[model samples]
Target: MNLFAALPEKERLIAERFDSLIQDIKPLNSKQLAFLPRDIQRLSALLTAERSSLKAGYMNNAVMLSAYTRYFMRWNLFRLTSLFAGMDTTAFDFLKDGDYCLDIGSGPLTVPIALYLARPELRGKKLNWYCMDTSQNALALGENFFLSCAARLQTEEGEPAWRIVRVKGEMGTRIKNKVSFVSCANMFNELYWDTHNPLEKEAKKYAALLLSYTVPQKAVFVVEPGIPRAARFVSLLRSALIRSGMSILAPCPHEGACPMEGKKGGKWCHFILDTESAPKNLQALSEKAGLPKDRAALSFVFASSSPAHQSSSKPAGGKTAGKSAQGASRQHIRICSDPIVLPHGKTGRYACAHWGLTLVTGHRIKDTLSGDLLYADLSAQDIQALPVDRKSGAKIVNV
Candidate 1:
């Protein structure tokens, strides 16, 4: 189920406001508009292939900043919206009426804007948002865009419930107050670019730094590109946080070591979301720039200082199923891969459980997708009867 599908009116409003904001920032002539696609392509290369050459202050360049807002920022917003929509509601329960949220590397206030659109219940909360970024220009532009969206969505007159505080710096910036939530989105890759340090060491260093900003009962969210390196980083970060006494809240059903980590052939953890519900103009712009996106893929980790809970017992789509029989063994498995076609008209998917990586195969597996939690009732005898795959050595269970 596409949770974003229900917000067509909200999506349209955001698209219209975003277009108007960009025009207001820089009114482009026909010639400039024609060259916008090329500019976007160049920026994309800097963010992907030539990322090592990118400087911390690259957003100071007007053309590059405008290109990012026009292309990358919009896509990121949609991606985050989809992520928040599919997440369990309890993950965000730490956000109360009076809480502070520190967003590190908050380029153009993407996280704030996404929260407003995806979580409507948060709109009325008297929350304080501290947006931190290296580029002052991006911070200012993001603040303007956030306010513009808020003005349109806010129905009751008086003052807006959310407050924005722009801090012009990167991670480790001195924040005076302890925050309840800390979010870092699409920024860690830039920080560790061109580094030769081991992923576990780097994850430990960064995890300690990020946790310093939060108080008790704190929550942290980190998102990165779905590429091999970034996903590996997320896996390592998950391990580091767990070692630091934090609980893994999403994407991982168990606190055990990641089975996909250090696997041969660069197997990493990541998930994909369909982009069909994205704005039409964004799709057209992507095609024009020769960068069509059928799906938005990312690797992320959500952790909390609170103890881990047994919330994965519920089935996918956030719905609870009836209780099992007295002696029936229940297992929660997190689907890690898309449906894999097997021989003889059967389907298979790689999953993660308390034991380790598992290969779940069955006749009818079309209903589940990547990043879904599959609840299975299997007894000890059922488990003992399953076969194992040779390549990955994962036990095969027919559901």
Candidate 2:
């Protein structure tokens, strides 16, 4: 039986809303939806105010709190709803019926909510769901709404169903200090730009934030907006975690240079018009798993010197994590391919998307806590192209 088969009817209902949101927005085909769910404007605004808030004190700043609150929840939702619908099963499949989880930038608790709703088996465990974000108001609203909405399931047969704490702070840093799994969704580029494009100091803060929150853990899942850079971002983060010595359990389904990153560049993110209009890459697969290629492509720039694993585990102190603290910090890259089948009678192989590539990295270290290789840093190798036409077999593996 599938793991999601035993969830509550209500939970399944809410999850369907997420699905509805995807269909309604139509981010893939719709020109308008393309660059949207725009959390950047909100991000920019929040960053500006956050700088101000610190001047006096966080206390009694209703205005700052208001903005902070909205920013946090909206950002969380913007980052993850798509992810929950896209992913089939993940590395954290081993989570107990109930366990502690950290949803970094947990847009409205998309990951945690979906996981709980989709898998009701986790109903009784003490789910100390940590919701960390820089928007305090966002966290407050999100937490309150969640508490109210989820109150019914808080307990079953006299046991606490879920205990969530929404903390308003930046991701990429420590919160509560420990966790089983940490989910960073749709905030990569934003945080990446923080160092320079968005604001250099913000960038460093984000990096430090992640490093602070990441190192000591069992499993950490890093998901980006399914844009051109999303895959690359995840790849780099995956490499870093692995280098830090974290065992990677369920990683993204894609194993290649994403389809969007050709010389011409490609679109970012995908949409679901309905169950009928899903991306072919997703439907044609053995399982409608992972962020599909037919979805908008995500691009990533590589760092040649250090492996993803090694770089990822680099401590916040600008220190590279040790093999003990950062298990996967060694240089071991993972190659991913979006396997496609060609037609016999037709001229070339049969794949829907225009182009695709595989993702590779360096560094391999067992996760310090879980003994998996996702606990450290990563260095990128390359995004080699797949040979096309019947004359060329997919050579994505060799690169």
Best candidate according to lDDT: 1
lDDT of 2: 0.39
Clashes of each: 0, 94
What digit string (tens of lDDT, one per residue) describes model 1 on residues 229-313?
A: 8888888898998988988777777789887763448457878777887788889989999999998888888887876432422
Q: State TM-scores per candidate.
A: 0.92, 0.49
Return the top candidate by TM-score: 1
For model 1, which pairs clash? Answer: none
* lDDT score, candidate 2, position 45: 46
Against the true structure, candidate 1 has what lDDT?
A: 0.79
| RMSD list, candidates in order | 2.7, 13.8
> Relative to the true structure, how large is the alpha-carbon lDDT of every model?
0.79, 0.39
TM accuracy, model 2: 0.49
